[model samples]
Target: MKKNVFFFLLLVSYMAVAQDTTVKKLQAESGRVIQKDPKDTLPKIWRIGGLYNLNLAQGSLRNWAAGGDEFSLTITSILSLFAFYQKDRHSWDNTLDFNFGFLRTTSLGSRKNDDRFDIVSKYGYAISSKWNLSGLFNFRTQFFKGYTYSTNVKTFASAFLSPANILISPGFDYRPNSDLSIFISPVTARWVIVKNDSISAKGFYGVDPGEHSKFELGAFLTANYLKDINKVLTYKGRLDIFSNYRHNPQNVDLFFSNIFSVKLSNVLSASWNLDFIYDDDTRLFGDNGTSPALQVKSLVGVGLLVKFGQGRER
Candidate 1:
């Protein structure tokens, strides 16, 4: 099934490229969508840009916080590159992105590592001024290493796992107004990994006979708004709701994240994120002496975004 889907995406991409080439050839000969103003007729492209952030925080009991953190830090890098061509009623878009990050926390004088890497691409098909659909594919990985408890033993199987990935996601966007937009994505992601029989008991990577990675569904809903704060600075807010459903354990997890951004200029920006998560099946099989439902939350994290390009305007 995954292989078939991949082939379909390849076919679509090729077809789109072929169509674009033909369109360009015809336009060059007849001067299609030519502008009266010479400045508007030149190819307009927005080059890619990226952002990197190093987050450091210290939480202590004296701070009156519900949770005590023994000094935690995270470093994240996000890069996005896209080129768009607009001619009259039609538009062509291409995007590529990569993100890699690591988080470290000290609990009870012991340090732990959490790392993640993601790569994604999107090709958009514009149907109208207010609507467009896109093809999305992404691959992600989280690694586990070095442990102090028996629980840590289970982590070994997750390490070095090839990766969990999304073959394709067909998504849509709707703009009700110039300043507001909404979007939704229905997607599936799958993975193959090994695990300690004693720990996964049911098998790892959901390969335990009755278990499978099928129907690993996910969805996202987002709201975006922007306000101008100055000639060069603008403020924006994004509210996002995300969820994941895996059939093996019959579980559903949901996340809510809100981000505030301040664009310093075309090439630099800063953001703060507040995220919360809820899990419907945090418990293991047969009560396992663990809670079956769970809720987790986090507050404001500072981050930064930067774009770099040669002879390119961000």
Candidate 2:
């Protein structure tokens, strides 16, 4: 009986040791898995930034040989704001651009030379590595009254919101890199607004006579590109095309804009801007009366720029 009891006690001790060994093996495996697992990192969610430029020029001449104006002054300013967000395959970008200029000459007096206000917002959800489902909204208008100067008279041409354009589109976006994007929308809604009664009465900007606004359904395509040519020069451009299905579908509207900025110093820079537009419904008065034509504008200036905020460097 004593030998049997001793053997049973030995068997119980071995069973306890085996159970402890199994538990230690499971703990060691769990520790390895915990060390091998990747940490969950948070994404950078928001980026906000803006650029502002103010340009000034003045000239006073006493019997200039080149026959320029006796006294002239020009002031121009460009301001742009941007807000961008990215989180978990979703992105949103918003931008506001404004430009205004005034020129004073001894011969022509003080007049406004440039005016523009544009807003763009885009949101996207990634569908693939290079493609996204996107929605875009755009609004464009001018600041103040504009006039056409002639030898005899100065005719009122445009005013604030007189030729405002608004566009909303839901589409697919292709973005191969951070510098380029292309968007295509088969169905788009566009509005032309003429808030001024005088301008609306004349059927300006495709609005019917006595109507304040006009709406159209169309297809819209937009392409945007940004590049740093070198350390000192940067280029940004956008092209927009639209075709009105209810109207003359063959006559597509086009808007293209380009801006090149060269940094001369930390605060001083030179910039060149070019804008082109072609709208079939808009009329321009020429020697042969009224006709639709492509419009072009260009500006070049050296200015002081004040930049702020944190964003993707351009």
Candidate 3:
């Protein structure tokens, strides 16, 4: 895995050098020098934008005959940001996503509803109108400590970077359009990192007892898509599949996520996010917490919608 990562990085470096050489040769044919125009108002080649969502709800029961909570509150926030660049044959894109939710009531007071942090970066060189040579780097983790509640006890589950996932791959991407991309990789490297000692000892997310990290060499494929169903509705989704060549290759790992949005007005919108995952190495689900099972999560909110930027959404 280390050797493959090294070679992939080296190949990218060589490609950059070759591109630089071509640029120099092209400049040699021109003798006139152009000065930067102070009055030029052209847009930059790179486009940056982000969307922020904040949803809040509160309920109060006054003189309630039926049994009910006196006060209840729910708050959820999600932030997504992206920067994309396309110049000549080279393109680079980066994105960050964060989410957190809080819930409070008279019975279950102030429990965390959700938490996650994820980032992705990819670079591609166009090989054709519909194909590109690409490399991807992705990292996913959570922001806060997580807990599993029982009848009377709460068990510690995870913390920031306690069980983060990192993936690196060199692949070919087929772009049918600006809104969709499918990447295929025969070689992929993935790492599961457990930063907390206590968590590592417990071996929650595929790491062995007392081990800090686990490495895997595998094949990975990912697809990203975005579509506008209409003027007021939009959808985004991603799919990932991987198979470890060394251990249990027949049992593939999968991750799928979907996001849907409906615009009600300029400042108000409804959104829903659904995520599902299944890993051969993770056996933390089911009634015994020792058998592998599908994990699912979803969040629905109606809140403020704020978007900034010009070009595409990824």
Candidate 4:
């Protein structure tokens, strides 16, 4: 698993570097001076530097096993990092995010684990300074390395699979300021045509219930906010909501997460994360429909957010 992750990261880094060189070459040779008059006062073309964060989650949010609450004494942890880069005035926004984690049950001295790799690309057309129309494309996979016992047999498989979690959504965004933004995607279509395994585990959020991999309809909404106080403190928050009704085992889920940061320098920061998850489908986890389940998790993390690229235009 570690080797694959290393190779994937190396490949992505190479691709990003190669693409930038191509873009530079094209701009240099194209006789079209894509710049405006010097006195007219339009900002120069420059690429936006990317932003990154590394997180360590603690408490109940750390458990990634099949059942919930039964592992309260468990100590689970998840590590997530993200980056984004785009050109000013460029109508498209691109993003790449990765999450990895494991779970350990202290009460029973048992351990279980899984991880996910997600890459999302979005294209947007600015409606104004505060609004935009966009489309999102996502590619996700579950990296599972553990034991599965069935049919009087036990086998261990270390592999990655993503059954029918692939879909495209057309959405809209509203950004009131640099600190807050909202996105809505309604009447979106989703289909999970095939998966490499029999029983489909949880969906992308790790909070959603299990369901059949087939055609599904849903809506998506996300809210994001960020604030900085002086050079020492900052806060960021995110909310994700998703629902699908047309597929087997109907479900609705809401997930809220926040991060508080203390800057030690221009390039280094310390962070703490809080996460909460709530869902309406108890049957998704094969429950008897007796009560609702909520998952809460927190973490303390420290990492570097490196911005590698030319600064953006004002």
Candidate 5:
């Protein structure tokens, strides 16, 4: 009876030791996995990223009753950069967006159909979890010469920096989540610049005749939102409005943009973008002549896309 009792006690002790050993082994394995995770080494204060896309299209028509170009080709390229920072109670975000495209038709030859360059920066000091004091700056211009190819004649419309815009606003920023932001400013400053001597002399783009720049004080509001609807679909939108107190306060300026992206693969995607603008001072040429009107542009493309850097943290 004494020998049986001692053996039973020894077996119980052995099982306890084995269980402790297994627990220790599991903890060590978990520690190794945690150490190997890349997120543990990634920087939290600064995030940077870039996106580039290239698209091409071609069409050839044989003899058809409906008249069309014999052969046509279009090429477009878009590049964007992002730099964002967050630490303590301070935050800063900056972005640069550029796009250019050209089309070649058998009748019209080669001509530019799209050109845009925009830069935006915002800095904020937190006043609460969802509100902050913010300062915003934006600049917009075009890359190359643009023309109106009406009546089979190419008439020069605009050139680089001929109608650049600069805007600065100090206001309150509201951010309810990582994907949405809103800003409003009661006093905003804006400048319309025409660097081209000929364009400035013609009083193009809201600038006074013979003047290179025009200044205005206004009220401004801006909103931006971005979201991924699913693993393969994404959307982004922005809206901006300004009312000039010194000029036509009733004729407010408007700008709106939207983008949708569908991922087809790791490196290929399809995208659609639309932009609308209405500024009382800016003129658009129509069948009659140049007049202030709402302007709209849209693009659809499927192409290769390259992305880099860490994504936004929630």
Candidate 6:
């Protein structure tokens, strides 16, 4: 079944490319093709930009009538970046993002609050004005160890590369404009890698006992959106859905993320992030330990926003 699906995808891709070539040929023969002006400056082919935010909170009480921690400190930092290349019918897009945070208090000692790292890359060849033959690559993991405390006992939960997820997909991309893209693929491959022996031995994240990786074949769909609501407000989001044919296809996985930001000044901004995820194979969060549950995360922060490198303006 996998071989047949791949063969069909290849056939479709070939036909689309051939049809595009024919259309271009006919247009040129009929003198309908618009000619490029030699005097016009070349469009910039590379775009790079990113944003960074840091948050800090601290409190110290020498002697207070009210009860409070003697000393407390909290810090969080985030980095989001993107780079893209575009010329003629070919385009490439890439992004890398990181989020890490921790908090310390005299009463509770120290605890991690957030941790994440992810990267994505996609390349496309235009098949029409709004459609492209595209391939996408994405990888996500964490940077620091995660733990849960029960009855003052620290328990290991996750770590760097302990639950790394990697995806490779080839399919059709529908991009109507600079701010929206919808990709669909019938043949998507994903590998969940666990480098930690302790995590792997327990079959965490769907890996078999004592195994380092698990493979999945699926149909995947992802939609990305970005919009500037006005001079001060902006919104961006992404939604990813996958159906695993090798396992229970009906029990699909879903992940969604959204960011809303408002500019306060030239260097200051406020932003909020919200994420939701669900995977049938992730049974640890369920009450029965055999089912799946929705997981949600959210954070709000106010900090600096920096922009560099030119991107074709949206």
Please report the candidate that would top TM-score against the real structure: 2
Better of 3 and 4 by TM-score: 3
Going through the candidates in order, what is the number of backbone clashes in each? Answer: 2, 0, 0, 3, 0, 0
Candidate 1's residue-wise lDDT over 50-158, tens digit each? 4444344444354555766646566544454656445554545444544344555565343333344445444556677788775555554554443323333323333
lDDT of 4 by residue, 161-255 (tens): 54325658899988788678787898667555324343345332232345545565789777878777666887777787778765433456666
Candidate 3 lDDT over residue span 173-208, tens digit each:
999987899999999999999999988887777789
Structural similarity to truth (TM-score) of each candidate:
0.52, 0.84, 0.84, 0.57, 0.83, 0.82
The collision pairs in model 3 are none
lDDT of each: 0.49, 0.90, 0.89, 0.58, 0.88, 0.86
Ranking of candidates on TM-score, top first: 2, 3, 5, 6, 4, 1
C-alpha RMSD by candidate, in order = 18.1, 11.9, 17.9, 17.3, 10.0, 19.7
Q: Flag regions of model 3 displaced more than 4 Å.
A: 1-43
* Per-residue lDDT of 110 in model 4: 44
What is the Cα root-mean-square deviation between model 4 and the actual structure?
17.3
- Badly placed stretches (over 4 Å) of model 1 are 1-40, 56-114, 143-167, 177-181, 185-212, 217-253, 261-271, 279-305, 309-314
Compare candidates 3 and 5 on lDDT and give the better one.
Answer: 3
Please report, as a residue range, the 10-residue window in candidate 6 with the lowest summed lDDT.
283-292
Question: Model 6 residue 55 lDDT?
Answer: 67
Task: For residues 95-186, write the lDDT of model 5, one tens digit per residue.
Answer: 89898989999988898878989999999999999999999999999989888666765666688888888999999999999899999999
Query: Can you give the lDDT of residue 264 in candidate 5?
Result: 95
Model 2: ten consecutive residues of lowest lDDT: 33-42
Q: Is candidate 2 or candidate 5 better by lDDT?
A: 2
Q: What is the number of residue pairs that collide in model 6? A: 0
Query: What value does the lDDT take at residue 54 in candidate 5?
Result: 85
What is the Å distance of residue 293 in model 3 from its true position? 1.4
